[model samples]
Structure formats: structure tokens, C-alpha cells
Target: MLMELIFNLGLLLIIVILLILLSWVWPPDSPWAPRWRTKKETARAAFKLARLGKKDTVYELGSGEAIALMVAASEFKAKGVGIEIEPFRFFLSKITVWRKGLNKEIKFVRGNFYKEDLSGATVLYLYLVPQTLNRLIPKFRKELKKGTRIVSYKYEISLPLEKEDKKNELRLYII
Candidate 1:
């Protein structure tokens, strides 16, 4: 029994090490955008542009640490979903949501945001770079319904803007 226990522990340790290494190496081929935490001011601007309501479901792509998700849920009283590719940030955000008692309002999923279905989202929030935005335009066009709001910080989407906040550098588009 002692020998079996030792062997099991050694195998567990090796599995843990492999997982750690895999987590550290960002998937280059995947549409895994870099981590960019949106500032409170910027998040507020995007939320305002979205005009969120109780019925609204806000989905934040590349939601690093879920700062924007927290703001949307707490301030705007909207249901928020955050998708993060990075394992560390995903766990951190999940813990934060639980600690804040915002788990009812906010959800953090550890997966590629590109594969997530955006059809149900009333407001789509993004802080992605120009390349990612361009790449996602077709997906957005295919998935989003009419009157759905899209708020992008820093990088602009190829679509015509419904409203632009020059101060915060945010662009709002309606699908």
C-alpha cells in the first residue's frame, strides 16, 4: 500500500507539472487574444454606450480578470458572461465572482472566446486588438441579431459606428 501511494503521488506530480507548462504556453494558432484588462473608466464608458438594462446579457470577450464583467453586473444590473483563454485569469475571475457574491450575475468560462455563441448576448464588449476585431467581424455579422449592441474599446470594428466616444476611444455599433 505504501509503494502504491508513492507511485500515485509521483504520477500526480508529473500530470500537474505538464498542465502548468501547457497553461504557460499561449496557443498561437487559436484566436487567443492577449490579456488586456479594461480600466474602470473605459469599462464605464462602454457600459454607458451599451445602455444596459436588467434584461441585458453582456458578454465580454477576452475577459482578463473580469473587471468589465464585474462592473457590468454591479453597476448596470445586467447579467454578464466572461470568456477567458488563460487558465490563471479564468480561475482568478471565478474566485472573485464568488467572493463578491456576484456569481448570480456574472459567470467566467475558461475557453476560447472565439468559439462562444454570441447570439444570446444583448451587449458584446471587447478590448481586442485591431486584427482580432477584423477577424471576428464575419462571425459577429453571422451571429448577432438586429438591435444587439457592440462596444469595443481602443480598437475599432470595421462596421460603421452608431456612437463614438472620442475621450475614451470607444466605438459603439448596433447589429
Candidate 2:
């Protein structure tokens, strides 16, 4: 019984250590939005909103699993780049994109997207929270070229809306 108790205590200690590490890397309630997986339907709506095409370049900030990037690359033939902060999500997305034979079409970078340059993007896709969107207002205004499309799911930006999909709860803006 003493040995079993010791084993359990060790296991608990390991779990606690892991939690601490994760919290340090990805703080809960961060200004950056939490991971929210984009559904296929919502991704499709975003694609349509952006009017994506083969020549278009789509950048997804905080792309959790790169689902939206996959859709854009596969269906629209657009070049897709995803910026993911968490290591697990970044690795997972890279593997998934490669497995889908979209290595040439899609790229995944593990880094803070706020620090990356977004000037090359023709369309920017986001599923981030409203707080994050609010914070990105200046970034969008500065980096995005004239008439660049911005598609967001479940949150609206203060910028003038070019289009809105009420059914899927998404908004599109032009810069």
C-alpha cells in the first residue's frame, strides 16, 4: 500500500509539472485568442468572403490546426500560410498539411504572429476573439495593402464591413 501511494504521488507531481510548463508557454486568458477550431462550413464561408483564387495568398493568424489553411490551399488553390504560437498545434498543423499533399501550397510557422510581417497577404483569415481583433486594428491598417480582404468568424472588427454572412456568423472587410 505504501508503494502504491508513492507511485500515485509521483504521477501527480509529473502532471503538476507539465501543467506549470504549459501555463508558462501558453497563458490562459491571454490577449491572443484561445484555440478555436474552424468548422468546414465556416471555412468555406470565409473562403467565399475572401473571393480566394489561385493567385491569392491567404494568411491565417493563430491557426490552431490549419484547417482553414488546408481548405484554402486545396479548394481555392491559394497559397496558405499559418502562424501558430503553441508548439503542439504548430507541429500538428505542419504534419497535417504535409499528409494532405499540400506542402507546396501551405506553410506553417511556429511563432507569435503579431511579430510577423503580413504585408504579402492578399487575404487574412481569423477566428480569434473580439479582444484580439480589437488589438489587431492598427496592425491591419498598417500592413494590409489597399483592397486586401479580411475574413473573420464569430467576431466583428470596427472597420467597415464589406460583407457579412449572417447564416454562418462571419464578416469580411476590405483594407
lDDT: worst 10-residue window of model 1? 27-36
Where is the poorest 10-residue window by lDDT in model 2?
27-36
Query: What lDDT tens digits, residue by residue, belong to model 2 across residues 1-175?
Result: 9999999999999998887666555632242223447888789888987789999999999888889999999999999999888887788889988888999999877898889999999999988778888899899889989989999888888899899999999899999
lDDT of 1: 0.84
lDDT score of residue 90 within candidate 1: 83
Error of 2 at 131 (Å): 1.0
lDDT of 1 at 134: 87
lDDT of 2 at 87: 82
Candidate 1, after superposition: displacement of residue 45 in Å?
A: 1.4
Model 1 ranges off by over 4 Å: 1-35
Clashing residue pairs in candidate 1 are: none
TM-score of 2: 0.84
